[model samples]
Target: MQTITVEPLAQEHIQILRLTSTPHLSGGLDTIAPYSVWITYRLNTGANQHTWTAAVSGYRVLRNGVTDMDAASIVLTNLADQDTTPDWLTDLIAKYTPSW
Candidate 1:
């Protein structure tokens, strides 16, 4: 099994943010996690808003919200394609990161 994280953005955070799945999978430079999961979407934005915004739009959106991993995947997938990656989101990621 794998571990995932879901974080809700608060006052300064904005909205709920999730960051899950590791970039380093069995293969090097794969299409990323959700790609295999089979969820595709699109979004366009300014350079500054690219990362996080993408995350919000195409976000995987897991079926359940009880677990952290579920929420993280949805948020990360969306962030991967977005133009806005906020600090609160990053904070969540850090909390769940292996190093953290």
Candidate 2:
């Protein structure tokens, strides 16, 4: 299990969790495209929140860190239709909302 340091619970103004799946591309050459996943996360603002979903490749994520889930190659780059909640994430949530 990997870990990422995010904004402390008290300092955090927003947070989001997203699930994504990469589609299998079948083709010879020109038609082939790098595998990518469509992910969505919940953005919790101090006053409001929303969800943001996008189709992105693992390379992009590694190249550009995506919040606390950054550099999660094995976790984010794999092909699967499921949800993964890291322990750190759970802890973070609990820290913010003790009752949850």
Candidate 3:
């Protein structure tokens, strides 16, 4: 799980509802591949209750028999600045990478 900080939204409140991952299955039954990981997060905001889902994908590297995933490669959807990656999101992705 990721620790998300509620940043000041200028009269708006954003709440992260859920975070889930859909892993790519390998050839064997119930086997998961670490190459591709898809992470999805649902969020609700403000009084009107606007909700949205963001999906991010990244590949994990297997080096020295250890699995490693880079958060910098994970791209988040619906961000104001696509070139700039948020710290919180990077932390979240790093925290969840081990589980995948």
Best by TM-score: 3
Each prediction's whole-model lDDT (CA)? 0.31, 0.33, 0.37
All candidates' TM-scores?
Answer: 0.21, 0.20, 0.22
Pairs clashing in candidate 3?
none
Across 1-100, the per-residue lDDT of candidate 1 in tens digits comes to: 9998965432112233333553312111222233222222222332222222223322233334222223222334444423343454444433433210
Cα lDDT, model 2, residue 76: 29
Candidate 2 lDDT score at position 24: 23
* TM-score-based ranking: 3, 1, 2
Count clashing residue pairs per candidate: 24, 0, 0
Q: Find the 10 residues in a row with the least total lDDT in model 1.
A: 24-33
Q: Give the range where candidate 2 is weakest over 10 consecutive residues by summed lDDT.
A: 24-33
Q: Which candidate is the best by lDDT?
A: 3
Q: Residue 20 in model 1: shift from native, Å?
A: 19
